[model samples]
Target: MSSKDEKNLTQVTDKISAMDEPRRSTMQRVHDVIMTAAPALKPRIWYGMPAYAASASAPALITLRNDERINLALTEKAPFRAAGGVDGQLMPAAWYLEDLDDATETRVAEIVRSVVG
Candidate 1:
């Protein structure tokens, strides 16, 4: 990893480390999954949130939305074309993860691979 990328990951780790309870634990799990599933996605702290993108120019394909529970956003960049609404309608591109069950984790891995591919 480049020094800049390392620095960004460090910042993201620090932010996640400082989070309170379940949020911290949840984000850590999400981080692990993303890092393992999509090694090419650069980890960074985006607007005080943890986000992963393929490159500096590309939009974040995965981000944490933990206002209440752990939520993973598979951004519009992915082949999950249903995003941003069907036939030009607008829609949210996030999924509320109650927990990382085996099936859910498997699906998440598949989605990450699809997005990265």
Candidate 2:
């Protein structure tokens, strides 16, 4: 990683570490999921939050905050886009599968693999 990217990741980790435990834990869980599933992708801090992509390539994915929810933002330029959410609504900057149950986690793993592989 470049010095700038390292700085950004450090800033993100610091900000997340400062959050309350519940919120921090939630972000950590998401981070763990992304890192484990997409080893080729690098995690970086974007707009004070965590984002991952295939090593500074095009099509970045971001984790964004919307009200009480956290959502993933896959670039509009991404080959695959999530369906159903309207643009510029109260929706998050990106779309992620709503039900993160065991099945959903597996699906998320598959999606990450497809994108990063």
Task: Report how far off residue 70 is in candidate 2 (Å).
Answer: 1.2
Local accuracy of candidate 2 as per-residue lDDT tens digits, 1-117: 788657756776776687775667766666667778977676766555677756654446645442366576655444553444564334323545433566756766666665655
Please give the RMSD to the true structure for each candidate, in Å: 3.3, 5.1
Q: Check candidate 2 and list the clashing pairs.
A: 73-94
Model 2 scores a TM of 0.65
**lDDT scores for all predictions?**
0.77, 0.60
Measured by TM-score, the strongest candidate is 1
- How close to the true structure is residue 105 of candidate 2, measured as C-alpha lDDT? 64
Error of 1 at 43 (Å): 0.5
